[model samples]
Target: MKKLLAGTVAGLAMLAIPAQAQAQDAKGAIQVKLLGTAVLPDGKITEVKTDIVGLPAGTQTEANDNVVPTLAIEYFVSPNFSLETICCMTQHDVDAVSGLTGAELVSDAKLIPATVTAKYHFDLGGAKPYVGAGATYFLWVDVDPGEATLPLGVTKTDLSDEFGFVLQAGFDLPVNDSGLAFSVDAKRYFVGTTASWYAGDTLAIQTEHDLDPWVLSAGVAYRF
Candidate 1:
């Protein structure tokens, strides 16, 4: 009976060693997270010059807020350092605001922002807080002027691709003994673009817009 009990104790000890090592090995592992993100855009069009009928110079433009589902992949170089890349696409409605007539002209656009960040994590017992900074390359696509701007003789709009900077901060809370954690993150992107409006193949207006936006996200992260 004593020999059988000793053998069972040894077996359980051997199993516990591998489980502890597996948890420790997760520190330098790669992780991927799926996040639900809210993109709140505070954008403004500046230096507007137009020759499209009643729309005069200095007409401004604004962008509406949008939400998107996003994904991020992270590689931990060390326990305290990691590199991450976030991917998502957001669509915003653009409105041309006239100070003279108090009329807002509506248009639509789709934006895909590619961002890469290097982060430093702080160890806080069960919670980890991180901060990062990166750059974003914004691709503006499918710019369409709806019927609202057709009467103003606006045919189409084109936006130039832009590069910008981003700042981020977030925290992760461990859910259990496993490698899963709950994460909440926020990032700010400072971006702008030069847009050109065309009226039947002729350039009608040129404007520069500051498309600074804030992104907030929350999701679960699994460390491998």
Candidate 2:
């Protein structure tokens, strides 16, 4: 009877081990992400290139170095899925040059890129990785001083409204149940605005431009 009881207890212990492991895999967590990038201009479309009513041929256009940074918070819906909301801040300079005559202004903008993303997280023992896809509504805030110049007095461009799609990938390094996450993301923005010249007569024209951006990031996460 003693030997039979010992065998039964041993079998129960083996079963308990797998159950504990499975339980550990089901818990959810919160994560934070940071991003950095340099933005490059994609150039004017055919319609803008053919415009005869605006700035003349001697007119020059200059776009400054655009560096964007982002901070985001994510919640795990499951071991393999999560959702995130990100805040983005960007600053740049735009200039118009015509026959050594020019005007320049510096502009800074803040944006909240809210997204509900579906993530596929990979478990690779100590280092876990993930990829995500989603759509974002870009809420823009102009932080400019509103001073600009042009031969035609085309001082400013309205770039306040935009929407975009996002794709991302990253990895996590465990720090207990929580970890540090490093990520990279790319977004294709569909943006359009009215370029109004404030010279003698206020002339307004609707122009379509691309504001596509990309980012690289690193941040922290905690699991409970």
Give the number of the best model, judged by TM-score. Answer: 1
Report the C-alpha displacement of residue 106, candidate 2, in angstroms: 6.8
The 10-residue segment with the lowest total lDDT in model 2? 41-50
Q: Which ten residues in a row have the lowest lDDT in candidate 1?
A: 98-107
1-224 in candidate 2: lDDT tens per residue? 99999999999999999888667755556777666655544313223423435445554444455666667777877677788777765565555444324455324534455555667888888777788888766565663422554443554444545556777776777766445444555444444332333334454433344545554555455544
lDDT of 1 by residue, 1-224 (tens): 99999999999999999888777866547988889999988668766655556555556667789888999999988788899998898988777565533343445688899999999999999799999999999998678874556776887888889999999999989897677889999999999988777889888767788888999999998887
In order, candidate lDDTs are 0.83, 0.56
Candidate 1 lDDT score at position 55? 59
Compute the lDDT of residue 41 as modeled in candidate 2: 40
Q: Candidate 2: lDDT of 119?
A: 75
TM-score of 2: 0.66
In order, how many clashes per candidate?
0, 1
